[model samples]
Each structure stands twice: as structure tokens, then as C-alpha cells.
Target: MPEWMRSFGRAEDGAVTVDWVVLTAAVVSLGMLAGVAIWGKTGGAAKGIADYIGTQGVDTTPM
Candidate 1:
């Protein structure tokens, strides 16, 4: 084989960039999933809080 072909086969330094890209993509996907889950819960939580406040017998009418 030629010297250049042997050199290409022996090189290992470029793999780190690929590994970092994959890791970053995985982290971003997980973050988006977490945001979706949290968003789904937010409305329910707000409703619960409002219900609790309403049950306290305070007048809900605006001043």
C-alpha cells in the first residue's frame, strides 16, 4: 500500500469530534423531551392551585 493510505488508516484524532456531536445531540433530545413532559403537567398544576385557593371561601369577585 502507499504511504498516504497507510497514514490515513493509522490516524485516530478525528473520532473525538464525532463523539462530541453525538453526545450533544443526545443531550438536546433529552432536554426537549423533559420540556414536553413538564409542559403537559403545568396546566394541571395551575388548575389544582386555583381550585385550592377557591375552596378557601374567599370571594373570587373582582374588587
Candidate 2:
């Protein structure tokens, strides 16, 4: 190989940018999953509370 070509064909030492991008993507995905789970539980809890209140004859209609 020509000396000029050899210099241009050097192997990369490390790939910090790619590693960071992958890690950030993983964290974001996990966070979104957790948020969805928590949101579902919260909605269920709210529904249960509303049902209990209704059973107790509490008037929930807005004035």
C-alpha cells in the first residue's frame, strides 16, 4: 500500500460518541416504559377511588 493511503487507513482507537448515544437511547426507553407502567397504575387507583366514593353516595357532579 502507498504510504499516503496507509496513513488515511488508520483504525479508530475508541468510539466514545457511539457508546454514549447507545446508552442514552437505552435509558430513555427504560424511562418511558416505567412512566407508562406508573401511569396505568395511577389511572386504576383513581378509578377505584371514584367507584368507592360513588358507592358511599357521594355526589360528584359539578355544581
Candidate 3:
């Protein structure tokens, strides 16, 4: 029933900080999820490029 206690309960000075922290965490989690989703495809594409390069014949001659 104290005024100070009521004010403390109603204080919202840190609300923005909390919101920023939550939003940053959400963004980082989403980025990680996207990276994980693309991880396998990226590796496969890189390997395919490597295989294609390996299969190509290289001619070494002087001009």
C-alpha cells in the first residue's frame, strides 16, 4: 500500500532494453536457422563445382 512500491511496480524504464534484447535474440536465431537450412545445399553445390572442374580437361601448351 506504499506509494514507492506502487511506482516501482509501474516502472517501465527498462522495457525498451528488454524489447531490444528479445528482438536481437529472435533475429540471431532466425539467421542461424536460415544458415543451417542452406548448409547442406551450399556444400553440395561447392562439391558439384569441384567435381565439374576436376572432370574438365586442361591443355597446357605454349602460345
lDDT of 1 at 38: 97
In terms of TM-score, how similar is model 3 to the real structure?
0.76
Query: Which lDDT tens digits does candidate 1 get at residues 2-28?
Result: 999999999998899989999999999
Query: Predictions ranked by lDDT, top down?
Result: 3, 1, 2
Error of 3 at 51 (Å): 0.9
- TM-score head-to-head 1 vs 2, winner: 2
Candidate 2: regions farther than 4 A off: 1-10, 54-63
Q: For all the candidates, what are their Cα RMSDs to the real structure?
A: 4.3, 5.0, 2.1
Q: How displaced is residue 25 in candidate 2, in Å?
A: 0.3
Residues 1-55, candidate 2, lDDT per residue (tens digit)? 8997886678454568878899999999999999999999999999999989888
CA lDDT, every prediction?
A: 0.94, 0.88, 0.96
Instruction: List ranges where model 3 is wrong by over 4 Å.
Output: 1-7
Given candidate 3, what's the lDDT at residue 10? 98
